[model samples]
Target: MASGLGRGNGAAAASVQLGLWTGDAIADRFWKFYGEETSTRAITRLQFLEHVGYLLFLKLDHERAQRAGRFAQQPVAPVDAWPNLALLSGDALHTGLTTLFDELGDQQLSDRPDRQTASVVFRDAQPWDLDRMAELNKLIVEQIDPYRWLAVPQAELGRAFSRMLRDCRKEIDSKIETGQTLTPLPVLNAITKVLGVGPEDIVIDPACGTGTTLIAAYHAMLAANRQLPPAALAGADLDAQMCRLAMLNILLHTGRPFADPAPVRLADTLKRKTPVVRSGSGAVPTVAICNPPFKSNGVQPDATMRDDFWAYGDFPTNFLQHLAITLPQGARAAVFVPDGVLSGGGAAATVRQNLLRNCDVHTLLRLPTGLFHRKGVKSNVLFFTKSTPKPSGEPATRHLWVYDARTGNHHTDTGNPVTEADFDDFVASCLPEEGFAARTESKRFRRYSVAEILASPKTSLLLKAHLTKELGDFGSPKEIAFEVADRLDEAAAHFRQVAEALPGQ
Candidate 1:
């Protein structure tokens, strides 16, 4: 048992490394600065990077001004001089650094000042180079915000770094203006394994934040020798900021091939009666994947226009329902939803029932609390496929297999986070027949028939309830009953003997 438990722990650690490290590869790169004692003094990776990047820009500007003596032409203003520089405006500084880093071929500054400083100098000056400084300033304000380093709390440094890296892609794109390029490493690794997401598969992320999913999908398709079909990928977000970020993310990652009308649109999918189809072309997506916001309360829509909103009195529940409706028949979807959606009463329950009846829910990967920016909210990934009406005799779903990865798990919010390697065993467990047998214990994961699920009150498919069951160690009922009778008879005789002795006296 101890050996088995140790093996499970090892597998889980690997999954965490795979998933978290891959997703935050860029942030992870910046976080290496903390290796220097000076970097650790700051509250966050964002703060450290911003302060360092700002200092570098200042030093670089001063050097440039010194080289071009007073007798020389007027020195150009430092790109960081703009008021928005302090505000961490768009991706200018980040993109510039990314370009600088790429040119330098290293992430660190040199120990020797001259050699290190020379890496950032522009050897070839163009007639329009001064205007490029202005463009850099605009990119900083429009693409990335340095202020985010200060705005994020110390406890949420990991999330801050993730957000910063995601935003930095925009800064890179504002200068270059291209197709989706930067892909979140972790998500890309996961999507690359999907057999169905080739060039032929129509992939979409309705809530494609930063276009991470779409970019990953695009790369995965390319690797498969499938040419990216026109309109093959699409994304949408309720927040215009997210839509813009997604567009920039795609462009920066893909190296801005052409002016593709933003594959992203700003639309509230939940309340809107009509799906926001992109450009009146392209088939409905065969695959959809997203980590939708988990808000449960009444959060107002980004726009007052009610056309695309899903009108449930509650917020997140409406989004879940909306995702279900938008997925075309025979399509497959992997969505991250809060645990409340699985068990919440009233409207949420209705939605769950409708989904189970209409869709073939194959698996539920239960994620632990504190795995997200907003900690302590339980979440699950529901993998399901939409299908046409089947004959009455055919079974719609025979069993719902659940992998409980959240059990006995702990993760620090820093560089060390849960990753795909941590989920390797869980993923392995998901393999059709082989995974089912490799379970260290049946309690960790088990299957339930559809009839058993429907028989439960509220038809709640609570995986935890099914996975944990305690058994008594006592003998069988008949053996226990005989033993109890013998003890009772002995007690009665002892009482009778005491009474008889008292009467005779």
Candidate 2:
């Protein structure tokens, strides 16, 4: 909590006392304002949000610098200096914003990686066009006050910015490519719990969107009393705007200087020569967590990629293979993947077989449906540890535990969102502190040997322990559609297996 912000009383559950507004509330105002004000020559909702983020970033930094007595040396940082909005208006305000952004790009962020991301955030940012600058001024006055930015602590502001990211994503969700999805915080927590991130471990996300996964890992590290430097976390994403957002997100969470080089890089993870690095004082990544793109058509066949990366012919499998091969031995990873990667025949089967052979593939949790941004997409989290070379050439994995959280459960984006408690039973079943023998099976949890897994059709890892069928309450239309799609996927996998068993091609 900030010094001035107040909490609501018992009766007013959704109320914020002392006029402290939430990030969701601020985003709603921005979107509504954009719809009513923006015209043909104006910016899109995405561009408007980026501009707002820039202003917010500057305002937050100004306050931080002022408190530290370092504000005197910076170039015209004028956001918080104004006592109120009445002093600036119209063309003058627009020109001032343009100059500030220009100076920010040219002077402050002109270095290597920072310049790259700043170029994206401030690219062609013509604030004078079609009343956008005026709109921004109006929003700052009415919704997000500069005084509020100064008053809130960095943690609260970071939380607000995170919530704003989630809210704003819903507005621009259609603009991004298919298979790009945002992970809800609770889902991120569940994945991190399985990894059990420690103080000394370095964490990375290959497909880091908005840096939420890395933020979750940061918080987990903080819980263990870790002294988190900016170099403790690293990530990469193909989208430049996403890289910018991730940089801002991590900066806000870590309380790093505003001009530090982004921990995330704007490079295609599949093409990067070295996937993992031990940067300045940062060690080799010991834990990796990601929700990779499940159905990306953008990943085309390229000669630059290694042959093993193309084993399953999809981004999800490629990412899995990337982590399996790139992460140092004894590193742990938890990846969210679609069901096809688990049950598909041919290349998918070969990939699963090799994964089990090369890594200690330990736990498979069949996640509930409707957990992702895509409608009706079924998914799961695969946990494993990279192993060292075996002199005898035996498989690395021994026993695989499967937890079926999808059978009798459902989740939704709005109506019934996923909570961390929803994963409690599954997390307990993982037995993070206990060794393998202490684990016990339940209705939704069971263990299978490597031999049994290999003998299954298509070498499928989509094993489920829950045998009880769903009761009479057929869920919402989305749930029904998800069930249908899941069944179709299962049928397709089985058909592929049957076809492979035929005498001739």
Candidate 3:
């Protein structure tokens, strides 16, 4: 009879599975209730969903706690109401979770004989367990569809999501104070699009912040496996915490344990004693990508760093040089550096000139500001390849192509961000044949001959001044004549006044 009822109520069962109670879905129901009860108005869709998810997680956690206490024969303490957990104000859930972990340590279970037995008291007691944390983070990421919510203006929502991520990190840190990771989605997408990875290529990200670049490279290699096999991906970071996170992220996303148990290392790349080649075969990476920390100086040159063929001592410049040295001959690289590196004087200028002469310095993608989490610091991607030294008197580079996507491109933090579509024209302009055809007649993209670049005072690749010249005159002939006439009239009046004063005397 029960089986028959289940078969008959398939639609009802499906609705329950979908988290729908009667007419409205969970998200809609929460928003409707808030609209009816709350005094405040104008809540965004993302905010409403975030509020609902927080409330649901809290209730679920409480129920789980109650069940665990009953099963373990423990005294029931007063339940913490956690009323403000659903507020979506600021890091409330993160703070609450931290506090819960602290309080849980005090609870004693009669069923547990020893410390190890008591350790598994609650479902989340061992939250820092890598597998468990990854599962929880995956659940949270699934609930919060980041791609869909990317367009949402609710920074409150972003804060809530970031807080959850921080809590995940905190849990991991509590157990094994090392190996935390972060993969910024935008950067990952950019790399996969720009450099299609193959099995032959050994990819590396030296400043592998949370292993995002390495993981992304791995995925890209997998995606391109139809034509080529997967490439070996490796990374190193200065922060041990970041290395941990990178390992965890890689394990979670790839479902494959790192081939080397110590896939990540905690060592400053700029300092001496840094290893140029991997152990054993002395294999160098064929492809590299990174957004290295931009520092003017204070980078101490260590023995290993000193031996770096690309070393010039400037922090970002040194990183650029290090990448050049570590990469195989004729290997391609894409690195992000500050605007100052492109046109700065002294060592920076020398490095830039050397890079152009030694490598096939092909493309420069001028990025807009605020694309990074950091503010105000403008950046660009220098895509070049290390090549064999050209014969004397022959130009290493014949034509330098500049893509001016920076000008007229503006995006606010709370509004729309620069997307792939925004870079379509710039990408088109980069093609060898299309050249200027893909670009607009603005101070954005202009080609420079090898001779022209050599003739420049600093041999700088600063495209703005050159681009402005390409833009031609902004003032019309009539506008120029009117300005000249006005200046002449003023001078003539002053001369007449001077002559009158002298004659009268």
Candidate 4:
């Protein structure tokens, strides 16, 4: 697991913190500095993030080389060798940074296959205004020490980056698009626990946002087997900034070098010929975990059409179909989908029917509303496995288990983040670790036959739990407020769609 860190660092280094500036604290300090920069300078949040990403990359690489004693015998160092050179003022710092970016670009092209990846990350990346860039470097070196970054565990560092990204977007306003949102970590943990990822399993997230889902899967794999299997992780994102963040996140989490090609790349997963493939084995992904963008428009008209486009439903359903068709038989998937995918009519219903015919749609988990950065957004997690077709051409799914974790579970983004405790009953009842134990059903958890599920109008999978009087079969005023907020959000979304569809919008 500590393969990338040099001699004195490993499992022992996981808990090491330098003086008072811990890893989490360092990330917080960076975020605070980011706010100051964005507020004072003329730079946007996106531009500042790009600047910081480059600086952090350089600092981390320098720390790694020092720990490994790479320059012990060298007579003279390269221009980029001394990260401390960033502390200089005016012309010296400017010259040092210009040459540093140049040397880094040249080194990235040192390999053949990695050139394009380098171009994607380093394209248009040059030094910003001297004063602003110098301030950022000073923050990294003086406040957040270079060696402190290497002292903490890689997973925590990766998570720190994720949190910082989330905070930057949430607290500060910017022109950045709202297409990507990081999945909450507790929710991610619950999904990975249900999937039970192992060392040998190749996990892929086609819509990876900052590589959160992939990192969670990596940690799950490490827990299953005490080894680092970075090559088994793969992801892709359409947004270039998101791809950059995912690359940095993966590098930090896996302790891989900046030069190595991350499992993640920049591409539209739906448009790519092969959406998901293991970088290590070149085999089909054994496990898929996705949280696709919500309510995105269908593919462009110029793009080639395929049957699995599935009635031109939203991206979530299309991504679900992509998994249903592309994954090999017996491969498993756990996808975070909106309530519309489970309950909406027309295209969504058809996709659900086709999914049942092709895959064993086993579990439906109704997640709490406002569980993401975006409020009033209700979502669900569908757990399923690809199955071989039956001789008699019957549907693959037999019994469907639905867990209603949403009703009366008024979890907001700030007030109550979803936690492992929230998933205890749901996990123990259906998703046990070892073997197939008998699952005891409760009021919130129920089992339904496929025929009964299909009998519902439009074959909707949004089944409500039958809570008894003892279980408090009622909604409080807070629940009513949440419902109202959700309805208002839906109405606002509908208006936005209408406005967008109008001429000259």
Clash tally for model 1: 52
Winning candidate number (lDDT):
2
Task: Give the lDDT of residue 192 in candidate 2.
Answer: 82
lDDT by candidate, in order shown: 0.50, 0.69, 0.50, 0.68
| Order by lDDT, highest first | 2, 4, 1, 3
lDDT of 4: 0.68
| lDDT for 83 (candidate 3) | 27
How many collisions between residues are there in candidate 4?
0
For residues 248-339, could you state the per-residue lDDT of candidate 3 as single tens digits? 44433443312222344446665633323233434556788876765453434675536645435556677787776556677778888777
Residue 7 miss distance in model 2 (angstroms): 22
Could you tell me which residue pairs clash in candidate 3?
Answer: 179-244, 179-245, 180-244, 180-245, 181-245, 181-246, 272-302, 272-303, 273-304, 404-444
Q: Which stretches of candidate 2 lie over 4 Å from their true place?
A: 1-48, 68-128, 141-145, 148-150, 176-178, 276-282, 307-312, 432-436, 469-475, 478-505
Q: Pick out the ten consecutive residues of candidate 4 with the lowest summed lDDT.
A: 3-12
Runs in model 1 lying further than 4 Å from the true structure: 1-195, 273-276, 299-313, 391-395, 412-415, 432-443, 465-505
- Model 3 CA lDDT for position 381: 81
